[model samples]
Target: MSLELDINAAIKAAMLGKKEAELRALRAIKAAILLAKTAEGGNGELTEADESKLLQKLAKQRKDSLEIFRQQNREDLAVKEEEELAIIEQFLPQQMSEAELRTALTGIIAEVGASSPADMGKVMGVATKQLAGKTDGKAISAMVKELLK
Candidate 1:
């Protein structure tokens, strides 16, 4: 519940500071968490992995919206999505740099003996597990394809 505590603290601070944009993002996060907690089959306590996955999902949603908004010339909407994304990503682990991702994926490839695109599944399964919360899946996929080729 540390995430919840931190979020609540942030909500209070945001309320004090009267930052409307940030307050909106923080409330959205709190709502998502509460909904997750009460959803059917929810176990009430989310593990660190669960928290990371949830944050990643939220970030992904914002990114996708941001991309679409940009494409459609909806800068008005894109700005809000970008702001929300920034706030959501703040709670996630630091992303691996491209160089760092390459190094890590290279090591995983060797460990799994994945030498061709055919072995992408094997490498991805391991990489996704090992690199959870550190990087997005699409980035990992692109790098894996590059390294394999």
Candidate 2:
């Protein structure tokens, strides 16, 4: 199923199951889709790629918020954000593990002829394009840096 269709179905299931956190995340996903559909320059609807990008962006925001909440010692808010993140993540592809990410990045680095940190940009450009929606950019970049050094 397409991400949008799956999200809608999940929303219905969440509502039926009385899963509050899942329901809230699904509603947010729906709202994001609506906004994307109506946004200026948007094609009046979201393509699957656009939907994936939107979902990834939402998931990234939740992860960032979870970090901030933890840093602020707001355990309640942190837990809430973590719950939302988990719900959001269910729609994303299974993430690449650290070892898997490193292996992939190594291949990308070799493919891009990146021999040192100076070539980090070249490696990152290719890696991000290839890995988008499969892995987080920050994690990929960090691994690339570590491998290149």
Candidate 3:
């Protein structure tokens, strides 16, 4: 099933169950889908790739918020952000574990002939495309830096 449809179903379920946090997260996703559909230059349809990108963006925002809230010692806000992040993550593809990511990045490094940090741009160009939905960009970059060092 398409992510949009799944999100709509989840919204309905959340509403029926009176799950406020889940309902909030699902509504945010629904709003994003609507915006994407009507956005200039958009094709009025949500492809699987587009959905994945949208979900990743939302997840990243929530994660950033969570981190900031934690740093500021705002437990209340951080908890909300954490809950939203978890909800958003459910729509994303399974993330690659560190070991798995390392293995993949090692192969990519070889394929791109990236031998040192200087080759980061070359490796990143390919890695971003290859691992887009499978892992977070920050994690990928960190692992790439570690592996290339």
Candidate 4:
């Protein structure tokens, strides 16, 4: 099913079950969808790639907030962000483990002829496109740097 449809169904289920945390996450997703549809250059709809990017962005935002809340010793707020992040993650593609990511990046570096750190830009361009839904940019960058060193 499409991301929008899946989110709407989840929203309905959350509402029926009176799941406040789940409902909050679902509503946030719905809002993000609407905003994406209306954004400049958006044709009032989202492609699969766009949907995946949106979900990743939301998950990352929640994670960042969770970190900040935890750092400030705000367990209550951190718990809420953690719940939302988990919910958002459920809709994302499975993240690659460190071993898997490293192996894949090795292949990518070779394919791109990235022999040194100077080739990071070239390698990152291809790696980000290939690894999009499977991993985030930070992990990709870190792995690429380590491999190139």
Best by lDDT: 4
TM-scores for all candidates?
0.95, 0.92, 0.97, 0.95
* For every candidate, C-alpha RMSD to the true structure in Å: 1.1, 1.4, 0.8, 1.1
How well does candidate 2 match the true structure in TM-score terms?
0.92
Model 1, span 28-143: residue lDDT tens:
88888898888899988777778788889999999999999999999999999999999998888789999999999999999999999999999999999999999999999999
Name the weakest run of 10 consecutive residues (lDDT summed) in model 3: 78-87
Model 4, span 40-125: residue lDDT tens: 98799899889999999999999899999999999999999999988999998889999999999999998989999999999999
Candidate 3 residue-wise lDDT, 54-140, digit = tens: 999999999888889999999999988888888999889999999999999999999999898999999999999999889999999
lDDT of each: 0.92, 0.88, 0.92, 0.94
Candidate 3 stretches with Cα past 4 Å from truth are none
User: Whole-model lDDT, candidate 3?
Assistant: 0.92
How much is the lDDT of residue 55 in candidate 4?
96
Best candidate, TM-score-wise?
3
**What residue runs in model 4 are displaced by over 4 Å at the alpha carbon?**
none
